[model samples]
Target: MKPHKLPFENRWSNGEHGWQWHCELERLGLMNVRAMFADHETRHPGKRAVIFDIPGGFVRDWLAFHDRRTARQQFLWRAIVIGLTLVTAVGTVLNLLRL
Candidate 1:
């Protein structure tokens, strides 16, 4: 893994249709990052990512903001898709009326 790659970046494993569903973590080298509350037993056996015990306040605030941002983006995309579909449906109905 490159030194600067984030946890959910290119290190993810490809699932069905090349979708990334999981990633692994390792305690490699002396680094600036820290892995807190890591279960070595589970890490080796399950090959799971090491848990990062981020502060509660950071998790609450950051995750809440991220969720809201993602929700807004999803809503925008859905609105665009629905608008296009409605336009297509109306056009089809108008064409049928002219037949």
Candidate 2:
């Protein structure tokens, strides 16, 4: 689905947090399909800042569904990673004992 765009740009000081906010907005179906930001001059004239389009809640249901799906996937991946780590640790210990 296409993302909805906001009329104005939202300014942020920290790029990482700004990007994360954009990602969350995209995940919530508020922004474009991709999270993007642009550099802009702040009201202070000389100060530079990053700006991202504010997201609109056009697809609330879709956003909710996506969030749930993402959460489930994240949980599954964490479980898999933990299980693999445990298996690897056990194998390493067994090999050490045999040697």
Candidate 3:
């Protein structure tokens, strides 16, 4: 297998973060920079300032978006949990009646 050059080999060694493509998303206030950082953490943890060393304000914005997304996920999870609980309760009642 041929080895590939890392994304930050020559140019960004001594430069700032290069998440310009996400600038538009940031401007729109729809981009979750924290989720972006989390993705980087999960995918490429030990690579310079890909996640941790970003500006505090940018990180904050990302975190806010992440929180919002997480809330939505929590709502969905609660719905699923309630549905399962009801199903189990009904099944148990049916079995007890048969016994």
Q: Write down the lDDT of every candidate, Cα atoms only.
A: 0.42, 0.49, 0.56
lDDT per residue for candidate 3 within 5-70, as digits (tens), equals 322222332223335423433564544555576677688666655434554344544556556777
Q: List the residue pairs that clash in candidate 3.
A: 34-62
lDDT of 1: 0.42
Number of the predicted model whose lDDT against the real structure is largest: 3
Candidate 2, residues 2-51, lDDT tens digits: the string is 44443223433235544455456556543443232212222322433222
Per-candidate Cα RMSD to the true structure, in Å, reads 12.6, 11.8, 12.9
The better-scoring model by lDDT among 1 and 2 is 2
Q: Tell me which of candidates 2 and 3 scores higher on lDDT.
A: 3
Top-TM-score candidate index: 1
Candidate 2, position 49, lDDT: 28
Q: Any idea how many clashes model 3 has?
A: 1
Candidate 3: worst-modelled 10 consecutive residues by lDDT:
6-15
Better of 1 and 3 by lDDT: 3
